[model samples]
Target: MSNGVDRTILTKEHASGTVDRDTDLETVLRNAGRLSPRDALRYLTPLISVLEGLHTSGQSHGSLSLDLLRVTKGDDGAPRLRLLKGRPRKPTLQDASPKAALAGRMLLYSSPEQIQGAEACEFDDMYALGHMAYTLLVGEPYWIEEVDRLGFMALCNSIIGGAPEPPSVRAMRRKSIRLPHDFDAWFVLITTRKHPDHFRDITDAGIALTSVLSNPDIRELSRSVQFKFNPNILESPSSAVPAAPENLRFTAVFTIVASISLAIAIVMLLRWTNAQESPKRDPSLQSTDGAPATSNPSSR
Candidate 1:
């Protein structure tokens, strides 16, 4: 080995011309914006399975990111994903060296424990997978804007202390994307600090995430519901789509009208029932104005 370093050459079968050998997942994501639920699951499922297998073997991918993944097109025109091998040894955060601290965007995918000098494990990989899924759904890392403004150290601080914006809220910036209600919960669960709170494994997380993304309610709500944009919160004011005020107003008006009508109907029914049930007064005893006969008139 050169310079007393042990090296090994790895090879695979030559890919056909139809396969896109040059593009990595990061590039594809940058070019394609956010992926649809179908596409995101398609890419993520296999990646999660890979991590699952590694964990099963008592190993872990300390560094996981879109950049580390290779995406190629199959002969059948479907995209295929492969995780590229990295160093055999996982870096420990205890080193606390500037190099480790300055790992750049990779920190975006790191878990809180990983940032705090803990050994990488299945939990860390699951946390990274949650970030990757969010990236694919939201078109960028949750903390990318902060990282761009403040630097990598800021990202580390945020990971250790700050909570990320819910995936559904971030996805709202893209009007076309309608993430399910439970998506945010799923994200939080996997990325939580308590290891026991996380999914049993990456495979389970993937399955649960898939179920959240595939929810029919998202599609139905997308058709009928509109989201109001708050410029103070979302990054892109221009991309913020306003809620349909007319539809909302119509709904409110209809509800009020229906309530009023029901109340009137109930009142009229009560009056009619009372009229029919009231004891009929004798004509001779009844007053001319239809008043009840007053037996005590003479006494008065």
Candidate 2:
């Protein structure tokens, strides 16, 4: 574990597959391996499992892009989704290079909150997963068109403030790109009808996306999505990634402060009520003289 007190060596295996056999998910998407909805679900199910496993191990794969997905055959000679690149490195402040902040890859795939200097958490991963889902379903990188034409700040502004068009719409616009029959329902469920201005977290949009992707058919997917929105769900329970201790401590302190403030407010409120209900001395008689004294109502 990195103590962040000294230099720690880190390594990432640079997971572009060997030249002869395997190809990245992006290349496949561009070519014949492009996924239909059913296939996309099939592929994403494993990816979610792998992501959960990473988080459970107290690591988040901060970088998840289309290129990180590798298409290779499993031991049984079936196609498999092998995720690669960026083993769980603790996000160090030193790595926050302004030059690399909005690099081309990030512009298209990074989460909205992440671009704003928020540390990458499972929520950020899930948000990026949403775009990845879009790329797979729509058979094209999500923001390629906009990024190609715009400047860096323009791209940043758009990703941060702009509303997203559903992937189904984009797929429909391309005559060559054919989406699956149930793609619309799936996209709508995942998006959760985002407000005109706001970002989505796992508690809201991410859980629905996760639930739907983990299931097989649209009917089952719909049910799973519905389950996440149910009041009884309480909070998102399957967050495989644990928050860092510092973050947890911060949350605890904030909660304590909030509770104390609430207690103080309640106490003050009770005191105010008691004062209102209790007997009040006549204004003039409040003086040493118990006899009433005349004074203008407006006088303090």
Candidate 3:
């Protein structure tokens, strides 16, 4: 347990040991790596076992704090994480139960202090797993941090207690720091509550993320097009890439023909209007010397 003075809360009937309190953050990170996808899942295998035990016993580790945890090397030199102290209180809340609220915060915010109440609901666990997967892929926190600071705070408020914001699409851009394709599955999985039928489960989310990230055909096509066109410097991509059909050569040709046809049609219409408005000379109008006669036909 941490050498710190934090009080321990009872997770089991008789709590055997305290929270891990080793001060080596690198060792703690190493232990975390054991559970993550980027590293061997063995080091972190015990965490799953702990979570499982919590699930079976209908109890949860309240007020989990990663900072307080300590890491010690086993005889085999593999990292082992021990709990140091219980969290002071629950981290965040949702409209759901304390457990559900905690789970939502853990998934949305990655805060250990708030996970005390996270129960093992299907959606909650799935979201948390996705959150873990995203952190693994991007080597950072959740995608929500990609937004501006205020927007990020507002998003945190919405996810935990405040009004929800629209799903962010800006994270998908190429210049974005953490690539959207990295968290494709997590995005789909988390949004599944909002769109159930599309992403059925975690497996589907993983597959979709993989496909978007690894599509060779799409990559090849993008490369081919990038080399083919020197887009107009003044135009944005939305304007440079016209909404014509699939075959770019045919589409460009057809667009040119259509534009020329429209221009000719407009010119012809303008000419017709100008001709109709011109004042015509009246043949019957009487005049002095140069003008002919005017009203003799009716008299004859």
Candidate 4:
């Protein structure tokens, strides 16, 4: 039985003796660089078949990854894939903690729910398979940038919360491959969180993807299924962090104070102007007596 660890294997031609020349899927991909859609599908079909068989047998490859798979040549010289038997124990919150000893590399191919500590299921395997397909077609892992720049926790958070750009979009960025727009919808359908939204089976997914790549006239996904970032994962723990509300409150107070001051200043200015403009009583015109000082006296 194959364990998670690497081991020598014998090909049909070398059945009499074990051959240590088996290269892992990762190595093969690295050597091959970006593969065409048809070539990528050729490699993925066998893996998808294996997962389908496992699911049919009431089992799941809880830890499917590139390194766990080995590619060897068959008697016909065609590439063959062999999956290792053991699956890693799922990581938990404790395992994902900063002080935990688990390596982030182990979680590179993990599904969103898997990163969130959900129990292993066929969906997780399918999700990992989708990522593998993307890597083969796009020539790089989806989260490679996050892994390099942000460390394990950020990678985990990204997996849980971040939505991956479509393979076609990433291919555009790479400038090496051109994929159909329909393939983008197919990727979303396969990797969507809602299990019921996925294809009927892994075989169906493979067939759909093959059709999508080979035929331009193929219809797009019947319904749009966009994977938005999980707010729960992306939300900051410090809910009390200052935001627009505080700034808005300060602005409102300042505006009210300014308006009042402006109003008061206007009132005072109007009163001062009225008093200055008012015609003062002339001393010459004022009579010494309280009685009226008549202009008639001047006339006499």
**Cα displacement (Å) at residue 98, model 4:** 7.8
Name the runs in model 2 displaced over 4 angstroms.
Answer: 1-20, 87-102, 174-300
**Model 4 lDDT per residue over 1-300, tens place:** 132112223221212334376777788889988777766766676676677788898888788777667777666675566777545575643475664334566666788788787888887787787778778877787666556556566767777765545566556764557766576677766777574567766777877776765664555663455544333322234222333467789999999999999999999999999888665455666678755556877668
Q: Per-model C-alpha lDDT, please?
A: 0.66, 0.56, 0.40, 0.66
The best-first sequence of candidates by TM-score reads: 4, 1, 2, 3
**Per-residue lDDT for 116-152 in model 3, tens only?**
3453343443454444444443344343342223233
Tell me the spans in candidate 3 whose CA falls farther than 4 Å from its real position.
1-40, 59-79, 83-122, 133-138, 142-150, 153-269, 281-300
Backbone N/Cα/C clashes per model: 0, 0, 14, 0
| N/CA/C clash count, model 3 | 14
* lDDT score at residue 9, model 4, on the 0-100 scale: 34
| TM-score for predicted model 3 compared with the true structure | 0.38
TM-score of each: 0.59, 0.52, 0.38, 0.66
Two-way TM-score contest, 3 vs 4, winner: 4
- For residues 1-300, write the lDDT of model 2, one tens digit per residue: 121221212222456546356677788778854675555655565666666666777677778887777776655666656677653432222344455334744656666566566766775566567678878876666666666655566556556653244454455654356554334455544333353322243334434444444443455433333211211111123212333468779999999999999999999999999889665654644556665566778986
Report per-prediction Cα RMSD to one decimal.
16.4, 17.4, 12.6, 9.9
What's the TM for model 4?
0.66
Which residue pairs show backbone clashes in model 2? none
